[model samples]
Target: MKTRQKNSVQGRTPLVLFLALYQLAGGLVGLGLCLKMIPALQQPSTSTWVGIVLAAVLYTFSILCGFLLFQVTRQAFLFSLANQILQVFSFGVTGLAYNYVAGLKVGVGVDFLTSWVFKLKFSLSSFTFSVGTHTGASFVAVNLLALVLLYLLERAKEAANV
Candidate 1:
C-alpha cells in the first residue's frame, strides 16, 4: 500500500514541479519589470506609484503561492487554489470583463506555450509591465491555467495523503 501511494505521488511530481517553477518564474519576471518603474517613482504621479505598488503586491503573492506549491501538502493546494481564484477575479474579470482600465493601454504581446512576454514601458502618461495590461487573452489564459494547476496540485496531495 505504501509503495502504491509512493508511486502515485511520484507520478504527479513532474507536473507539480513544473507549475511551481512556472509560478516562480512568472513572479520573478513580474517583480523585475516592477523594479524598472522604481526610477519613474521619482516623478510626481500618484497613479504610477499606485500601479507599481499594486503590481508588486500581486507578484509577491504569486511568489508565495509558488513556494507553497513546492511543499505539495493539502494545505498548499488549498492556499494556491485561493491565490489562483484571486488572480482569476483580479486579472480575468476586472481585466477582461470591462475590456480596459483608464489610462492603461495594452501593448504588443508575445505568447509562449505557457507564458506571455511584452515590453515594459514608463512614460509621463502611462506605465506598463511585462505582465501588465498587455493582453486580455494572456491574463484570462494564465488565470485559468493557474486554477488547473491548483486542481492538479490537489490531486497530487490527495494521492499522497498529504
Candidate 2:
C-alpha cells in the first residue's frame, strides 16, 4: 500500500511541476507585453496602437492566470472569481489609458473587432465615442464559467482522496 501511494505521488509530480512552470512563463510573457506597450502609450499618434497592444497583453495575462489558478485550486468557482476580477480591471485600465494617450476629450469605448471594422473616422473625438465589441465580454464570461467547473473538479478530487 505504501509503495502504491508513493508511485502515485511520483506519477503526479511531473504534471504538477509542469503546471507551475507554465504559470510562470505565462506571467512573464504577459508582463513583457505590458511593458513593451508603455512607450507607445506616451505617443499621441500611436495611442491606438498602444490600446491594441495593451489589450492583447492583458488578454494573454488573464488567460495565463486562469490556467495557473485552475491548476493550483482545481476549483472552478474560485477561478471564476479571479478571472472576472482580472477582466474588469483590464477593461477599465485599457479604456482609461487609451483615452488619455489618444487625447480623446470625451472618452473611447471601441470593441476588439469593431475598432478595425469601422475605420472610416480618425478624429480623436470619433474614436473616443466608440463602443467595445461583445467578444471581450464573452471572454470574461467564458473564463468565469471555466473557473467554476475547475472548482467542482477540485472538490471531487478531494473527496476521492479522502
Candidate 3:
C-alpha cells in the first residue's frame, strides 16, 4: 500500500522502479549496441570516426538519463522532457519520411485491434506494434510512455498527501 506522507514527493514505488528499469535497459542495450558496432564501424577517415563518436555520445546520454530516473532526480525529468521535445521532431520527420534514419526504418501501418488484447506477431530481432505499420517510431513510444507513467504516479502521490 502507498502511504500519504506529509510533504514528500509523491511516488509510486513499483511504477517508478518500472520506469527506471525500462530506461536503464534502453541505455544498457543502446550502449552495448554501440560498443559492439565500434569495431565494425572503425575506419581511418575522420568522417567514419564521427559516426562512432556520435553513437557513443547518444548511448552515454541514455545511460545518464536512466541513472537520473533511477534516482528519481528532478534533473532526470527535465532531461527527459527536453529529449522528448527533440524526439517529437525526430520521430515526426523519420516517421513521415518512411525511411531508415541511420540504419533505422520507420513505417506507418494500421493496427488491427480486437477485443481487449492486442494481438502480436513477434520475431527474433523485432516485433510488430500491432500487425501493421503506420507512424513508425524510433522506440520513442517507450520513453514517452515511461514519462507519462512517472508523471501520473507523481500526481497520484501528490493527491494522496493533499
Candidate 4:
C-alpha cells in the first residue's frame, strides 16, 4: 500500500497552511475588536456597531479559510484565494467605513466632503490614539503585504520543487 496524496499537489501545501494561519490570526484580531466593543455596546454608537459587524464578517471568513485550508484538498486552493481576497478587500473597506463613520460623527462626511475629512478630526487631544485614526489603512497595508509574501513564497516553493 502507498500513501496517497489528495489533489496530487503537495507542493501547494505551504500556501494553504500559511493562508490558514494568517486567517486565524486575523480572526483573532477580529475577536479582540469584538471584545473591545462589548463595553462600548452599552452606548451603541455607529462606530461600535460597525466594528461588531466587521468583526462578524471577519470571523466568518477566518473560519472558512481555516477549515478549508487545513488539508491540501481540491477546494483548498479556492478557499486560500478566498481568504486572501477577503482580507485584502476587508482591510481597504474597513478603513473607508471607519473614515465615513468618523466623518459623520464630526459633521463632515456623506453630507459634505470637506477638507476636514482628510484631516485628523478624530482626536485633537494630546493622546493621539483614536479608533478611526489611520488604523484601518494600516491594517489593510499589512494584509496586502501578507498576500504579496504568500505569493512570492508559493512561487519560490514551486520553483524549488521543480
| Model 1: lDDT of residue 47 | 58
TM-score per candidate, chains pooled: 0.55, 0.32, 0.50, 0.49
Ranking by lDDT: 1, 4, 3, 2
Off by over 4 Å in 4: 1-15, 45-51, 89-143, 149-162
Candidate achieving the largest TM-score: 1
- Judging by lDDT against the true structure, name the best candidate: 1
Clashes of each: 0, 13, 5, 0
For model 4, where is the 10-residue window of minimal lDDT? 99-108
- The per-model lDDT (C-alpha) reads 0.53, 0.37, 0.42, 0.44
Evaluate residue 144 in candidate 2 and report its C-alpha lDDT on the 0 to 100 scale.
31
Residue 6, candidate 3: Cα error in Å is 10
Backbone-clash count (model 2):
13
Q: Provide the lDDT at 57 for model 1.
A: 73
Q: Which residue pairs in candidate 1 have backbone atoms (N, alpha carbon, C) closer than 3 angstroms, thus clashing? A: none
Candidate 1, which segments miss by more than 4 Å at Cα? 1-12, 41-44, 90-143
Between prediction 1 and prediction 3, the one with superior lDDT is 1
Give lDDT tens digits, candidate 3, residues 62-130.
557656655455556556445333322222223232111111212222232332332222211111212
